[model samples]
Target: MAEKAKVYFTDFRCPSWRENLPQKLARLMMTAGFGDIEMEGKYVAVKMHFGEPGNLAFLRHNWARVVVDLVKSQGGKPFLTDCNTLYVGGRKNALDHIESAYLNGFNPYATGCHILIGDGLKGTDEVEVPVEGGEYVTAAKIGRAIMDADVFVSLTHFKGHEQAGMGGCLKNIGMGCGSRAGKMEMHSAGKPYVKEKKCVGCHACAKICAHGAPVIENGKCAIDQNKCVGCGRCLGVCPKDAIEAANDEAPDILNKKIAEYTKAVVAGRPCFHVSLVQDISPNCDCHGENDAPIAPDIGMFASFDPVALDQACADAVAAQKPLPGSVLFDKDSGCDCGRDDLLYANHPDTDWKVCVEHGEKIGIGTRQYELVKI
Candidate 1:
């Protein structure tokens, strides 16, 4: 049997004389062996989500300052990063993405580090990395900037996810690091298509595609499926936001792909992970608006093994009772309020275990863990 990975945990309790939560988080990270990494003069990519415009559940910049300060203390050059979103939102492109991040209070002044959108201006700048033991994706399209970093660190906000059951470390790293095309590949088996009503025949997509996928006719645009390569460049340049990817991939396969993409990211790097199990929202922070939290704040977690960290977090969430007014407790008369698996009870169709199981199968990390309290 594989040895259990050590996961460090610290609750959000502080007296007037005690250290603050951020300082305690820094201590938790050090206890998890974050200080052991050789970080002198290396570029460290701190991967995290800059919440959507109106989402209040996302991690505050104060939490990121802890990681940034620690990295700087070790002489590591750190920068915050997250790839552009596949969906049409505040974070689809670099400029708008930065604006949204700033709008959500993740500016350099707040986080004590610069923000780099992993993909370039249009979400097309990517590096095709070969997934060593991948079953679904052979070559995962990761963001160029994220892959360029010498060290990777994930700062995740552990929460309930509608599609993947829970958005933990793996979700934050795998789905977060993938380029637009990578996201499309994981979410859909089919290529992108142009919506006729939204298409203005701007010919921007036609000009950008080397394959001549976008064809203009009758002052409207249509994508030729045979010629399209699914690079996802058209989605960024569409003035009318007409081009859209097909979300046809099954939930299980999507979870597997997320695991595969995560393998492509942290396979050969010095990686560390930290998760704050607070504001356990029902949906992703990608939503423009955030609903009430499903559970009360549990605490913070840190680990060298992301898989173990995620497993520990899932376990912690499972131990909590549902918040009365949240969706988990009010899902109708058939709601399983007493269910031990809160994540599954919240989203019955999604199984969060699939991602971790696939992650372990792909040789990233094991799900078994020993929680060490600080």
Candidate 2:
């Protein structure tokens, strides 16, 4: 058996006289050995999600400010970053992505760090990273800017997810850091398809596709799977949202792929992870709107082992009863089965355990942890 990883935790409560949430968060991070990283003069990428426009559940700029300050204190150059979305959204391009971050109060003045859209303007900038011992992904297409960083830090918002069961440290660093093509590879089995009703045959997808997979027939476009390398460029260029990536991968595979991508990012780099289990929303922040939290705010967790940190958080959330008016509470209240499995209860189609298990299997970290409360 392996030794347990140490996961440091703290509740949201702060005494009126002492430190505020941000200051307390700083203390929590320091206590968890964040300052031990040799960040002197290194380029540290602070990967995080700048929530989709209209989704108010994303982490506040204040949280990022604390992290930026910490990095600066350690003489590291830090930047806030996330890759362009594969789907049509405010953050599909670099210009729009920066604007979305700025609009969401993540401006340089607010977070004390410049924002860099991980993938380039059109979501094509990428670096192929070979995943060591990867089962699902041989190589991961990561954003070039993220791969260029000397050190990596994941500032994650822990919450329930519609697909991966739970969006925690691994999801934030893995799925969030992938380039558009990389995202498509993880979510789909093969290629994308055109929604006939939504296709206008404008040739937008074909114009951007280097593979020429989008062929026009009868004034509508259909992707030629044989010609397609699953680059996912067509999905972004389609104005009508007609081209959709295949969502055929089973939940377990999706989770494993996420773990593999995570390995690609952190494999030869110094990394630290921090997850604030607040805004316990029922879906990923990628959604245009966020649902109410299924549970009350838990706390902040920090660790060098992302798998252990995530497992600790999942355990914490599982122990609590769902909030009175939350969607999970409503559903569980009407059922005879227990609601202890709050994450699965929130999204039945996904098994959050698969991600952590695979993450441990790949030598990222251990799920067995000693939760040290502060």
Best by TM-score: 1
TM-score of each: 0.98, 0.96
- The reply for model 1, stretches above 4 Å from the true place, is 332-339
Candidate 1 residue-wise lDDT, 113-228, digit = tens = 99999989999889999999899999999999999999999999999887888999999999999999999999999999988988888899999999998999999988898999
Query: lDDT of all predictions, in order shown?
Result: 0.91, 0.91
Considering only N, C-alpha and C atoms within 3 Å, which residue pairs clash in candidate 2? none
* Candidate 2 positional error at 140, Å: 0.6
Question: Looking at candidate 1, what is the lDDT of residue 175?
Answer: 93
lDDT of 1: 0.91
How does residue 191 of candidate 2 score in lDDT?
A: 90
Cα miss at 311, model 1 (Å)?
Answer: 0.8
